[model samples]
Target: MTDLERFKNILNEHREELEKEYSISNMGLFGSYVRDDQEKGSDLDILVEFSQPISLLRFVSLKRRLSQLLDVEVDLVMKKALKPRVGERILAEVVYI
Candidate 1:
């Protein structure tokens, strides 16, 4: 399978654990990986939705956990924090897992 497929599978497999630990209600993959245009250093772009407010520390922990799980750098973003225009484009192509 492709790296992207592996990443999606890994995340789906750990979805329950991550949701319980991070209060994440939903997650989606976007950016270069989604477009199949990623370079060697491209980080996985994940748009995450939390079920409740979480501290910055917890957010960072989530990012780190995902990076470890996928064995790739993770650029996590809060779905609620997205700007209108950018969000539209991202949401357009995002693949939720």
Candidate 2:
């Protein structure tokens, strides 16, 4: 399978646990991975919407856990934290998980 498919499967495999643990309302994959142009050592970009705001500690924990799960470095962004123009572009390309 392609790397994208592998990533998606990994995320989906842990989706329920991640959502409950992190209070996530929605989650998606974005950036280089979504565009299918990730190079060696590329970071995984993920966007998330939480059911409620999470503490910075919890956010960091989530990011770490994701990186461990996928065996790739993760760049996690919250939906509520995005800037307008950039948010639009990211949302347009995001593949919802």
Candidate closest to the true structure, highest TM-score: 1
Residue-level lDDT of model 2, residues 1-97, one tens digit each, is 9877899999999999999999999999999988999999999999999999899999999999999999999999999899999999999999998
- Give, for candidate 2, the lowest lDDT window spanning 10 residues: 2-11
Candidate closest to the true structure, highest lDDT: 1
| Count of steric clashes across candidates, in order | 0, 0
**lDDT (Cα, 0-100) at 27 in candidate 2:** 92
Q: Please give the lDDT score at residue 7 for candidate 1.
A: 92
Question: Candidate 2, after superposition: displacement of residue 57 in Å?
Answer: 0.2
Model 1 lDDT tens row, 4-94: 8999999999999999999999999999999999999999999999999999999999999999999999999999999999999999999
